[model samples]
Target: MEEYGYLWQLALILMSTKFLGLLTKRYKMPQVVGALLAGLLLGPAVLGNLLSGVVIGGHHLENLALHQTDFIEHLSEIGVIVLMFCAGLETDINELKKCGKASFIIAVLGVIAPLIGGGAFTYWFLEEGWIEASPDSSLFIQAVFVGVVLTATSVSITVETLQEMGKLKTASGNAILGAAIIDDILGIIVLTIVTSLGGGKATAGDSAPLWLVLLKIALFFVFVAIFGYIVYKFFKWWRQRDGKGMHRHAIMAFVICLLMSFAAEYFFGVADITGAFFAGVIISMTQEDQFIASKFDVIGYMFLSPIFFASIGLKVDGDAVMSMGWTVAVFAVLLTVIAVVTKIIGCGLGAKVCGYKNYQCIRIGVGMISRGEVALIVANKGIEAGLMSSAVVAPVIIVVIVTTIVTPIVLKPVFMSGNKTASDVPTTSKLVENYEQREKIGKTNR
Candidate 1:
């Protein structure tokens, strides 16, 4: 009976996500929005509790305990790993190299400004005794948590928007993509620092050694670099062999994904997604990357990604939001604005200083404003680590959702206008010669 109950819960989750995802697509919004709504509708604040006591043919729904929620959550975490892996796989190394200086400057400012702003805001509120936590709770910990939230800039939406606007190959698009990749790395480091400070067990003075933390991160990448090279060589040799079909290539890529994900968690103390990303990156070095990426994309978009977004909404405490009332609303708005504005000012100023045109700077800044799964994952980790409260997590979730939704809508027009102007300009012989020269240099390095 218990086993059957677990199956029923899983069925409900799948059905709800599929139904909501289809509905959202019909309205032209991201499928993620619909999936999240499904969770909200099915969760305790809505129909969940009312349906809690009801049973089908005397099979009590109460038998399906909340423990099943853990299954959904774990599945969602896997979804994140695969999603990040896909992102890394799609990244073009040459494109990133073109935006090198601008991307670095923007990424640095984007990280630093938010860290200071978020930390300052937390210190002011905590010092004023505004929160309900123990007075002894470390302000530094809370500030670090805020900084962590501010550090992420999810590029999925931005990339899609640029592609839709036909500006994906443009300078602004390249800068945005490069800056976003940097933002993800910075976010991970911030999370590592904050998690280390909190000591993982909520107790004081159990913090990991700084050297150990640095070693863990460094070693993870070193393993990836070395292992990645070996795998590429093996794949090249395999391609030279008689078995060069799709089946052989797919199996090899899948194995690499699993192995890298395992090593990341078990050996490096970094997030499994980080390892998965490196796995994808390594696989991407192969000649068959385009084919493999297409296969993974179909599976990821059709199923795993939607389930992950829905799970976030399901895990949220609707009752807590209502109970907190105005505080949650105010915090969500304030945090969302800060998250968006700081990224723009930081990345925008950096782009301008790096000699990009005004519109190019704006586009890059807007591109860095979107936050998605990465923010949610970090927030969830903070909750589990006891460094962040439910109150804090809820607002951060709201900020991520809002930024993701707005970035595409906001960036499209700016990108489109830029494209129109560039298109109207005639390609003179001198311009064509310069373009060919640059392409030659780019190809030579590759």
Candidate 2:
């Protein structure tokens, strides 16, 4: 029999996540924190390594071998996509429209600040003998690539954190989500530009001309518009004919989510989460959205979500940290600090310019701090293109782990410290009135 390793791994993950999730909840921290800690504890960084060495009578210990596997990775991917889809279902389109301009500004500044900050820091660090570059590699290009890495914002953690606090519908929450989506787009464009500058190498999608890359992105929107309309009409028709709460509707929702996700990465070079999010937004306009969300929520919560959160912690290679020596360890620590502070300052300045209150600005900045896997992906691309060394991967991993852990811890308190204003977020009834007012204004302008 093929060893049933995955079964035990899944069991350990779910049990530990549940126990630690409740443990963190009792301390008024987001339960996601506990789930993260659980992964760290069970992963190679901590317990996995400790237990791997022990043996009872001749059989080697195999229980805590929660090293991340392909199976768990795929499940976690579904969990995050599902999480973002649920977020889209809850989003108010009208409200999102009101913040659209602000979102773009925040994203632009957010990306620029980190790009500059990381690049400047890396350049200085190189000058100070912190980084050892590969032969004949341009330090300036390497610095730029590091900055590109910093420009990424992984909002899955932020989404979970905001949902737990019931702030997902708030102004700051919407801004964070909106900016993050735009940030991903901007980061991709910047990554493509930086990668293309490397010596005749195709890094990520840099093999294509910039204009072609952009055109594909534009076509992706067209794809969404056509497919989104079809989805909207089909869901509405089905709901009218069969009423609601059907299991098939929930199943169809998953199909649509996966289809969009595949098309995004495979065809358009966009993040799969972006496609999943738009799928949810399109569905949200249909009558079955809430029911679908409820059904999907249970699936995500019970299985995929825990695996997703835990898988992040499982990426930590404690041996890499220890082997890289104190000098590299110090670099990782400083880089982590730079990663956190740059995002806050850059995004916060954008919020302030958009006329948000200071508290809201702070919350928005904190919300965007989590780099997650986005940074790692970018760094990997840089390495493949020969613009970056393999050595940087360790520090980048540390940055991802730190930022992922810190975003939620800092975000919850920032949100709790401030009360939302009506101007910032319209009430449900006011949403209808504002929608009508905007309609009238559109007619007048036309």
Candidate 3:
């Protein structure tokens, strides 16, 4: 009876997620926005307490509606790994190379600016008279984690927006994609360091020494190289066997993903999602990359990922956030604004340094501003690691929601304006054709 409770939970989440997904799509927003809201609604924040009396299981013995969070968190964690793995598989390694040194430069500055912005804010909150000091967590480490959260970029939302504007292949667009991939790798490195070095003052002694941590990091990469080579060969062998559609082939890939994830956390002190991501990257050069990506994409987004997004919103505590007071609220607002503005300045500045025009710089900045799954994943890690306070969770959620919603609202008109951007200026002939094309496309479709 208890085992069957999970089935009921799954059924409710999937149905609610789909219904909200359609609603959001109808309103010209990403389906995820609604899925997250649905989760929040279903969880303690909204509908959880309201529906506590509802008996969901067939035997009516378990209270599925009232509190299914611990179990849901496990599902969401799987979703995170699957999501990152898909991201790795979908990555265009050649595009990353084509961006060349620009990707490195952009990623560096992109990471730096946010680290400064978010870190400075946290430092002020702790050091200055703004927020009361708690002995439980180290202010310094928590500040660093704040900066770490800002390092993430959710390029999927930007990809869709750029595609709609017919600019996905343009210079700025490609730069965004390439830089984002590099940014993820860079972010994982930063995360691994911060997570390993210790979480808070209360737990600093629990961290490995610098040398040991470095050695583990080095050993992890070595493991990745060797394991990646072996997996690469396995992919080749599987190809020769014509196992493209074979369930066993896909199952093996997943097994490899799970093993990589386990090894990263248990053996290397690296985040499990980072392992899953790199594993996907290792196999991405394979002929089966597309096949693996598509299958995992379906399984992840269609089944696992919505749960992750929803769980983020569901776990948010308005009371905990409010308890942090007006200063923290101001910080959240500032964090959101900084999250939006700095990426544009940092990445756009990098683009400008790369000889892109002002409009292209702006586009690049806009493209990098949206923080999606990765940021949420980092926030979850920080909270779990006890590096971030409960107060920061609300801010992190707000960062995800605000940055996601803000990017499209700001991007649509920037690309449509009279000013000619470097990558998107239409010639007179093309303008005439586009005008005619606009007549055929519906407003909702646009």
lDDT string, candidate 1, 53-78, tens digits: 78999887644433226677777777
Using all chains and alpha carbons, the TM-scores for the candidates as numbered come to 0.80, 0.71, 0.85
Residues forming the 10-long window of minimal summed lDDT in candidate 2 = 426-435
Off by over 4 Å in 2: 100-104, 119-206, 355-446
Task: Please identify which of the two predictions, 2 or 3, would achieve the higher lDDT against the true structure.
Answer: 3
Q: Tell me the whole-model lDDT of each prediction, alpha carbons only.
A: 0.70, 0.75, 0.75
- Candidate 1: lDDT of 339? 87
Clashing pairs in 1: none
Whole-model lDDT, candidate 1?
A: 0.70
Q: Best-fitting candidate, measured by TM-score?
A: 3
lDDT per residue, candidate 2, 67-158, as tens digits? 88888877777787887676566555655555578998999999999899889888787667665653435688888889999998988778
> Whole-model lDDT for model 3 versus the true structure?
0.75
Worst 10 residues of 3 by lDDT: 426-435
